[model samples]
Target: MDVSYLLILLLVGAFATYFSGDKLASKVALVFALASLGMSVYILNLFNAGQNIDFLSAWITQPKVAFALKGDGLSLAMVLLTSALIPIIIYSSFGNEYKNAKSFYALILFMAFAMTGTFLAADGLLYYIFWELALIPIYFITLIWGNGDAEDRKKAVVKFFIYTFAGSLFMLVAFIYMYQRSKSFLIEDLYAMRLTVKEQTWIFGAFFLAYAIKIPLIPFHTWQAKVYQKAPAVGTMLLSGIMLKMGLYSVIRWQLPIGRFAAIEHKNIFIGLGIAGVIYGSIVALRQNDLKKLLAYSSLAHVGLIAAGAYTLTLDGLRGAVLQMIAHGFVVVGLFLIADIIYRRYQTRTIGEMGGIRQQAPKFTSLFMILVLASVALPSTFNFVGEFTVLFSLSQINMGYAILGGTTIILGAYYMLKMFQQVMLGETNKKAFADVTFNEGFSLVAIVAVLFFFGLYPKPIVDLITPSIEHILTFINRTN
Candidate 1:
């Protein structure tokens, strides 16, 4: 099957949604997302049938650049994630009425195109194009539809745009330097280049700086909380659920092999930074009253652990990191949706303003509880599997690092339970709040089912990712 057909379908969906009226626009978007999901599953089937689905060819003659799209286990996993989440996001917007539903849906479909592109593109220049392209729709989505003070939204959007683009510049420089050295813009060629330790370290630093900022680790994370708090729920879902993974994915795809020695040599620094971000984010989350801000900081903490796992360079660590990336994406999106539910009912995100929701919305409470448990890495949850694997792998590297890194679990529980208790378990205030509507319930239930399903049996994902992880490790070991 020609995978380019999938891209064509997405573009067609974008145009169709753009022309449809408000009443029908959402339906068009939903259909598009569902079709995209079907296409993704078909791609998986093709892969299972032992066909290499990625398409690559010459693009620009003068620069000798190629347009390459490859789907290894990692890229396929991300593609599946993007495909799955878009429908949920589109569905979650059911209660939200936009002035121009056509434009709104079109933007969302366009964003989907960019995300799929980011995951599939294998050439450095092509990857960079998708990298920047992915940000455009989100910037507009947030700027046009975000809540809070207009100035606040503008400030947040500008900050997010500038921060991410600035990081991309470093990535661009790294890619150009690699192309200059190797005389090719192909990803595989860059990976194949022989470089001195110093060169590797410099390139690694450049790449790491870009990805870290995008992942927004520690000091670089200042923009995330504000942005999440200000952006609309759909925008928040897209950014936290899908876009952040670009950074983590890039780290695995671009930085590891290119900077294998740097990764090993500076493993301690990355690990230390990861630990700090995890602990710091957790502590900061404990103090946050705004629901969105709390979740934002929680995301920072979770990504930190994943980052540390990536730096470990151990098989289990890398596996756990990739799994955690997937798990976190789902869990965070669910959590944010829960936040959106509360905001819809009570019109406030402040924990102090929420109480006794369990009495009115047991279903919401139950789903929120599961997501919280997952966030805290409870047993039988996917988060537990990922966190345990990462910790176990960290132990292989250093007992002390494992011990320090493991505190995220404890800190995670403190903030998560605190948030849950405040929002769901308290005495009902005099105000009446509506229980979740069917559409809302469907979205939550779907996400909960996925979380539990994956949690109980993660072997499929683990099995799928193992070969790719092994392939990446082989490169690292060979280069070292």
Candidate 2:
């Protein structure tokens, strides 16, 4: 029942998939992904039962680091999201044939392993290691299996690698500084340790640079759309779905608690930066010609709002941010998979080339429409619950913040609905469009069911995450 078992399962799965031969790699990887999902659920149940599930052991004594994994409502919720979506992401790719399938599938599990570790690690050094580890698999996945011109893909992927990697170095520096002051790499020690205003500002700025680049807020977002367009569907799903959440989660887990002075001192500026990303991303998304690139911008807009909510530093804001992270993860995966399905049939990513699919593929249209509605935060959908709370949290801070943040809804609906209209409606095209295959439809349905189930009755999730959110808020309020 140790939390480390989850990491072990995925690591073993990656190696097994790599050696399983290309013919069996996909199926083997799927089985492993599902098993990991099952294990995470079991751990969640045990967590609720108040059983001891966290793991820690001595590692680097000089640095005071431990091979540590901790599970709380917050970390476990993110872990469950990662474990759950990975199976669907792996399944969604069954239709396409990739060269070196073993390596491709192996990297998927490897990436999942790194992401899960990132969520669960409690020691600062351990967390940073896992954070960086998550990047490697995705880097190879995009470079090897990506969709566009080889040169362009390389440039985009490399730029992403450099941006994220460089940003993380700042985080590392901050962590080292914290360790110097606190004399331990444990997150709790770092959080409890005191720092002068000067120190807090430097640490906060370093962590902000790291997370913002990964979150890719407005100015730092140049690397995002290109990378999404170039990467394969699965890579895009991992990036948009689970990878970005790492940055947001760290904002709550590491940055706010460790650097509360700076977080509080510059709250408005940080919140404004997030809202700006929302408006900027929404406007840019309006004009995107490529489907994946459009969705990428849409993700930026949504994440910007989530970031804004977290910076509000209210219990409601942090809670809503977690809720939206889970909600956005599933919805974005479904959206990109839809884009990939259309590409499979039409062999193009351009919106101008697509039309009248509503006439030919009712099932696909229905599912796509549902995903579009969810993206815009329609009532009774999961996104609504999260978005409403986030905006409300912003309102408590300032009406202007809420108003600007709320524009995501108006602008999101305009762009997403317009994308849907252009892509799914209008005159019948000469090219024949087939309905989603059982595999594709089944995946979409699974995603839709989660959104609706949680949207209508979100109490279970709200309950599970509240205590942890409160715990983090305590540290955040310490600066006051």
Candidate 3:
């Protein structure tokens, strides 16, 4: 089967959903999202069976770009993450009504299409195109469906748009420079080219600017909290759950490999930056009153650790980063949905206003508690497996790095537990908060099931991603 079929399926789904009329649009979108997920699982099986599933054809002969879609274990793993989350995100939104619902639902699928393309594209230009394409749908989604003041929403979304677009231009320039050196834009061609220290430094810096902003590491994270707070629950989920992984994934797949020498030269500084985000994000998350913003900062901290692990350039580091990325995707989506659930009942996101929900809804509280525990990397949860491996990888570099990174778990637990206490415990609010409905319960169950199942036996994920990590590590350590 052609890998491009996945992209085609979503694109067609988006158009079909947009025309499906508002009442049926969401359901249509869900069907397509589920179909995309199924297709991804099938493709993954084919890949595991050792069948070739990549698609490559000429697109622009002059610049040497190709319309190419390639899948390996790593990319397919990310694809599966994107596919799996889109359906859940869509399903999670069922309780909320939106104006012009068809457009909103269609944008969700379109964003998925673009994100999946980013994971699968084999050419640098193609990857960059998909990377940028993913931005458009979300921009509209947030602006149109977002919760905050129109002006505030506009400011946050525009800042995100400009920051990301500006950073991407740097990446585009880097790719252009690489194409000049190699005469091709295919990832293999770029990966194979030998460049001077000066050239590698420039390339890595360009990619760093792009990925850092998207991942929103400490200094580049100014736009994140506001956007998350303002956007609708589903928009926040897409951004936190699957969008940020694009940056971390690019680091392992493109940045470290293509700019091995530069990454080695600047590993400490970047590693410090990642660890800094972890501590800083955790501290700031502790202070946030808005639930989504708190979750946004929490995501920053987790991805920070993931980025640090990738920079460690060891198999364990990269492998753990991928594992945590998948785990975080599911867990964070559940967290945001929990926030949405609260909002649906109390019509408020302020943590202080959300006390005593446990008195009202046991099932919702139980699921929320599981997510909170998973978020803190409780030993039996999926996050623990990833977090422990990431911290261990950092230890190989320096004990201090591991110690600093480990603060995420301690601080994550503290703030998450504190938030839970304030929000779910304390005086039972006079207002009655509804328990999780069937759809909400189903979504939470699916996420919790994945976390626990993988937490106990991560071997399947480990086996799937190890070879690919080893392959990428070759490029990362090629010159070292």
Candidate 2 weakest lDDT stretch, 10 residues: 471-480
lDDT of 2: 0.95
Ranking by lDDT, best first? 2, 3, 1
lDDT of 3 by residue, 359-404 (tens): 8899999999999999999998999999999999999999999999
Index of the highest-lDDT prediction: 2
List TM-score per model, in order. Answer: 0.98, 0.99, 0.99
The digit string of per-residue lDDT tens for model 1 on 1-480 reads: 645667777889999999887789999999999999999999888987889787878899867788888887888888888889999999988978887778888989998888888888888989899899889999988999898999989999999999889988988998888888898988788888898899889899988878888887987888899999999999999999999999888888889988888888898999889888899999999999999999999999999999999989888988999899888988999899999988888889999989998998777778889899999999888888899999998899899888888889999998899889898887995678778889888998888788778889998889878888898888788933
Task: State residue 386's C-alpha deviation in candidate 1, in Å.
Answer: 1.0
Clashes of each: 0, 0, 0
**Residue pairs clashing, model 2:** none
Give lDDT tens digits, candidate 2, residues 1-480.
Answer: 899999999999999999999999999999999999999999999999999999989999897889989999999999999999999999999999999999999999999999999999999999999999999999999999998789998999999999999999999998998888888899888888888888999999999999999987979999999999999999999999999999999999999988898889899999999999999999999999899999999999999999999999999999999999999999999999999999999999999999999999999999999999999999999999999999999999999999999999999999999999999899877899999998898899999999999999999899999999999889988744
| Runs off by more than 4 Å, candidate 3 | none
Return the TM-score for candidate 3, rounded to 2 decimals. Answer: 0.99
